[model samples]
Target: MTPTVSGSRLKSTVAALAADRFAGRRVGTPGGRAAGRWLAGQLRAIGASVTTDEFPVAGVRELYRTPEFAWSAGSTHRRGVHRRNFAEHLVSADLPAPRTGELAVADSDEWRAKWVLAPDLGVAARARFEGAAGLLVPRGTDAEGWMPKMIAGPPVGALPVIAVRTGLHDEMARAGSGTVTASMPLRTVEVIGSNVHGVLREPAAGSPGVLLTAHFDGVGDDPQQRLPAAADNASGVAVVLEAARLLAPLLPDHVGLAASLLDGEEAGARGAAHHAPNVRSGTYVLNVDGAAQLGDGAAVEAGGPAHDLLAALDQTGRETGVPLRAGAMPSDNRRYAAAGLPAIGIGMGMPGYQTPAETADRVETATLVAATRLVVATVLRLAVHSRGLIALPHKDELQREG
Candidate 1:
């Protein structure tokens, strides 16, 4: 008999991961370490053997303080709210204190010691205004008018670059003559990240194993606001934990089952990249990234040799009534796939992705339950099929998986 997934348990897990106590669970922070410990304890509580893998990561982004921003046009001063009106660009130079300067329009010749406002920021613009105080680059916002946060990107630029909402950016660019003050206490640091692994069962000799994964780290909360990160990954972690809890006893004898709660996924999936090389051969990987909403269908991206595994997922979705579709999921699964393992990445939907508005209350319990059920069912099929208890689907049977 199949074990049932508990929605209430999933909610509690998400709340614990997204709570203020963890401070957004950024990789390499005390909060992140505490979160990893908590997850290890959870796995142990379920009677699984838990172990952690540590890896060194360089150049992780850290924001020490809330940045201040404002602009003035003929005494009409306006202070832009962080996240709502503007955000720090990943390539921005460090500026702890606000720097004020006159605003220079796009066609202005006097670019020295001024804030250049342009429709877009480019290498040419940076070289042209190398002496300017900073740049006011216009960027688009999400439908909800929020500028998302990013930790990894290209090398820092020579001048501070701030992203303003298109409307605010255009306003500043057209104002032509104005005074602007901006600051960003952002810097890079080297840190160690951890990946928590829990073993539920080991496959019989010559049998393929299954690895379930979900990143437990967030971009971290801003100094001024609480970025709960409930949907971005806490939700996905909850689903994985719930599936592990229910799948522990029901997993077949020939099937090896384990769960990996990863860190540093927000820093360009460094943790997965570090852990992939150690995965046993002939292992099938399933990674869940977003489970807060199941709009349209769950997005699936298969990498490496996963045709048979993708067919099993497709067959599972049809039986379970959860829709699956083709979509891009650039997450940790790619790392395992690169290691010559069969890996599949799944994403549902996230509401305030990587923003201050990502609160736990917005997560849908129904979606959580659905995601857990799908994962559980798929694992049962794949693990059991490895022992010839069930026949694997033909390659032509797989479709709608990217």
Candidate 2:
């Protein structure tokens, strides 16, 4: 007999996964890697096929070596001009260094100028001036005090661009020689990444395959700190895992119940974008991300024929006394929807979103379990409904469409 996912088990899983040490599971960090590994282990325990796909991100640097700058102050050289601490700065390449009379922005630049003064553009400007591989941004100030704001300039060519702390910029300002030397170490390579999958493939009367997806990666504001992404995503991944465990045995032999723990959803939705072109026709999908809070319900975001799927899910929630809300795509559901495939997104409730409390203790276990059951039953029922007219395309038919 297949193991049934129980509330007790899910609770334990949630508690263990949400432990303090995980540090919010932010993407591109050690914590995020730990979260991904944990997710892989969970899916493995449930017999899922797993594979990690690696890709490269351009113009990114890791805090490996700090660049030093110094200048001559009269006869005495006042050493140490600029410095900062950050894992990496996203910058553009091909910018020049500052020389006497080089254009520079002060605290009085217009907000629009500041807004457009993005690091990418700064790299471009620096490159235009110095013809360097990248730009060294000593954090500068705007109209306000030390705050995060974009720096504007032309597009920096292939060179990498990065932003350092304002303290560093002040040091550069003191370079009496009217020249500044900035240095930065860059990280460019292929890193290990992954995509988790669970499938219940079988033959059913005429049922089309159904797919469910959620990205396990979390984005973080701080490059160094661990982001305990409890609400942003850990919750969504949990829902998908629980659903797979519960529905595995009940799926019809001729039908397919597939779940994916996609990677790189934070880095430009690369994972979802990869899955789009490969979407199978006649396949239905439910994409869940973000945590759900207690007292609140899961939002439904599918329209068109897919709306029927949402309605069916909502109806099942009602029958089971689960409070599920309706809404639009907020996750990977956009992938399938954009592909013209039937798809929807389901999310949890939270007070301050993207924070730990956002995925608070309000996820109704009973409702979640009931929701899974309903999804399984509804998929089967819909498959049976579509079997009659949802023609199975022959090789010729597929070739013609292709």
Candidate 3:
């Protein structure tokens, strides 16, 4: 029997997870911890036995306040507004103190000890600005006039890199050259992130289980701005929670179902990496990353020993009237695949990815329902198929039949 998912429930969950109170749900922050606790409560309400796994996350940078950038043009001071006129590069190094120096173009040799203004900061430009005091690189805006936010991955170099708007760059160019003052104060600290793991049934020896997973963390909010990453991941978690509610009562006694709401996925899938080792071998994992919008149905990426899993997904989609297409999603699914588990990554759509414009209202409830139905159908189909395979004859019996 196909379990009915409530669209209203999905919308409410998305709203709760993406609310301003959650503080963008960034891992290692107070708001992030609050979001995790809220999600754990939701899981318990859905009748799943829940536990949390904690992992250490280091080098997380939070903007203490809006960064300030100003310059002198013929005795008139010009300032750039944070997020509007300028933004910070995630990999930029923290300045010991406010830097004040004459602005120079990247081509000028004097820029080595001055604030260099560059059109873009590619690898070559970054290399050239190695010895410079700092860089003012212009970043292109999207159609919505919002600057794309970036996550600090690995440390690029020692130089501080700030992304200014192209208009600001033009203004500085028109001024010829002037003394520029830029201040970016960031708080770098380490904290522990938690992953909520809930199971409907415990697995028996040599029994294969099904895993449904999603990351609940988003990019932390700016000091003065709200970045509710609803579509990027909150929507996904909402759908997964709905599926867990529907599957708990319907799953067979021999079939095991587990859901992992992970953290630190925005920080390079750190939570998934930590949880992968504890996954039982031969588990089939379905990881949902985005589920608010649909673009030609759901996008699915399969890896590891996923032949059976892929077939079940296709059949389930056909039976459930959900569309499925092949797509690559380099998310937490890859972590499970790397651990030699059959894994598939699913994404419906990401309307406003990693930006301040992302809001809970933008998440479509119908898309969430569709995603939930697809996941439930796939799990049921796989559970039956796996049981059949386990019941198949041994090699000695097959040889006798031959």
Using lDDT as the measure, what is the rank order of every candidate, best first?
1, 3, 2
lDDT of 3 by residue, 1-402 (tens): 334678888889899988989989889889999999999999899888999999998877767777878888788677877776778876677764678888887667566667888776654355454567788888877766677665546665466778888877888887778988887766566778999998878766667798999999998798888899899899999989988887777666677888999999988798999999889988999999999888688889999899999998898788767788998898999999999999999999988788887888889877888888788878877777655432322112211000
Q: After superposition, how far is residue 353 of candidate 1 from its true place, in Å?
A: 0.6
Model 3 worst lDDT run, 10 consecutive residues: 393-402
Q: Specify the highest-lDDT model's number.
A: 1
Q: Is candidate 1 or candidate 3 better by lDDT?
A: 1
Worst 10 residues of 2 by lDDT: 393-402
> Per-residue lDDT tens digits of candidate 2, residues 277-336?
676775788777654453566676883258667665765566545567666545677877
What's the residue-level lDDT of 317 in candidate 3? 83
**C-alpha lDDT of candidate 2 relative to the true structure:** 0.52
* RMSD in Å for model 2: 10.8
Q: What are the clash counts of all predictions, listed in order?
A: 0, 38, 0
The C-alpha lDDT values of all candidates are 0.85, 0.52, 0.82
lDDT of 3 at 4: 62
- lDDT of predicted model 1: 0.85
**Which number leads on TM-score?**
1
**Runs of candidate 2 exceeding 4 Å displacement:** 1-5, 20-23, 56-192, 202-206, 220-226, 294-296, 303-308, 356-374, 383-402
